[model samples]
Target: MHWHDEIETELQQMKRELKRSTNWNLDHSSDPNIEGLENVLKKLNHLTGLQGVKNEVNTLINFLKIQQLRQKKGLNVMSLTLHSVFCGSPGTGKTTVARMMGEIYRELGILSKGHLVETDRSGLVAGYLGQTAIKVDRLVESALDGVLFIDEAYALAPEGSGNDFGQEAIDTLLKRMEDYRDRLVVIVAGYSNEMSRFINTNPGLQSRFNKYFYFEDYQPEELVSIFEGICQQNDFKLLKESRKHLLAKFSELYIHRDDKFGNGRLVRNIFDQVIEKQANRLVKLPRVDRDKMMVILAEDIPD
Candidate 1:
């Protein structure tokens, strides 16, 4: 069973603590940020499907707890922080979970302002000379008091392209992370092998992000659950027959994917296609049978 399935009690404990601390009902608010963070963590746990990865994240939550107490004491000490590197394959739910972590850090007061700014080589680095550094500087200023997540970070420094200005952007970003150490969190993500090489390229990037989180692929059962959940989310019902068919398809896809499945992203892509087929089938009927409209049949999803 997934550890996420057990987090409901922990969530309840947080709520109870919140109520006891403030008798004036201060916790009540239209806070999608809080809700979104929880959702993201839950999704992360689900996508990860690995015990080690989930355990590492538990440490992060503890860090937030300690930071919260330190702030409450009003000691004014600098908050200890880290720039983490998420090393894994694609579809490991890094982006979704990191986005939530941004909100969590904000909600817990680790950062006065918590926002997640995402970019890749193309977004932070430019095509022209001297422009990459300038753009990366602006990006840093924008994420001053928030979190900056750089996906596919290894691309910033590639082979034989020593003159590429992306390196300048990388250097500038590392320095700013230190300058605003108290206020910002930077997470660098990409494939495991490539990311290792990328980090080894610069000590500045290496020491800041001391922690590493590896996202492993999902098992067959987990992939089944993912597909079922996606179907239900899109208002498409997964019938028993269709469920079996999906399982079969997943087995075939899983083998071929090898490393391409990328955790459960392949499941999501398949989910998208199945839902689209379901929609197309319903579009032809004028008078919709509410009962049948959302049902997904084995025939609806072609191999």
Candidate 2:
């Protein structure tokens, strides 16, 4: 056979073997905590922004569901590598989604423990040569049967820093990833450009992380909705004019955003500042009514 034909034949054989290996009974009711998976999906649906992120997650969920269904039918199941690369800016909900994915995977019988262990360069890298490997290994151990979310993961590779121990941590993590492939999932998150560079830094990284999800920055309206949700959750109310003022402020923030522009985080900071200003405004009052105490006025918005 020609080279292309040979490759196709091999792939067909592999599929046949997978089908045979995963043959089993198709009773999903026996699975434990199935409702947990549904709840995770529901939460993903409820998230205000991240339409792209939501679609990607739902696709993965559907794939896993199919895999489980195949297993139930006593057919061979294909092993899935759940390791992923999350490319986005700060406050883009990468960490939040990672945590939820852990739970979803656990409920799907993909992980034994669905907890999330969040870390960064400081959590994995060390000052010395050998110590870096040890630190990374320990973190991988703790993250077993769960998800290990490494934020700002590109920082693990500092360009032109020959003596940097970050490379050592990456090496250790790669080994552990393979050793515990069935029980652990590692999610590396960073800015899109930086994360692309980081992935290209190691050939192994590209091969190991097959899934990439990009989180787009929240739009002005979504940011406003987020702020409103925060207010409702905290029992705070925005006056009619204050609501209009806040929307305009968010629109301005979105338009003039720089690399450091934090979408959700910026809204949160504004909310906090508004609360502080409201407190300062109310302190001078001889007596305050409940309505006044909970209401946020237009003047409370930061300039």
Score every model by TM-score.
0.78, 0.88
The digit string of per-residue lDDT tens for model 1 on 1-303 reads: 568866987888997654433311112212234565676567657653666777787677775555445545764323344578898888877887677677666665556567889989888988887888789888888887678899999999997786788788888887777566666789999988889999999888777667798877666677888777776676778899988898888777767775556556778777778877877888888877977887988977769
Q: Compute the lDDT for candidate 1.
A: 0.74
lDDT (10s digit) by residue, model 2, range 202-246: 998988887899988999989988998999999999889998999
Task: Report how far off residue 94 is in candidate 1 (Å).
Answer: 0.6
Candidate 2: regions farther than 4 A off: 1-32, 76-79
lDDT scores in order? 0.74, 0.85
Backbone clashes under 3 angstroms, per model: 1, 10
| Top of the candidates by lDDT | 2
Show the colliding residue pairs in model 1.
83-209
User: Which runs in model 1 stand beyond 4 Å of their true positions?
Assistant: 1-51, 67-80, 279-288
| Ten-residue region with minimum lDDT total, candidate 2 | 21-30
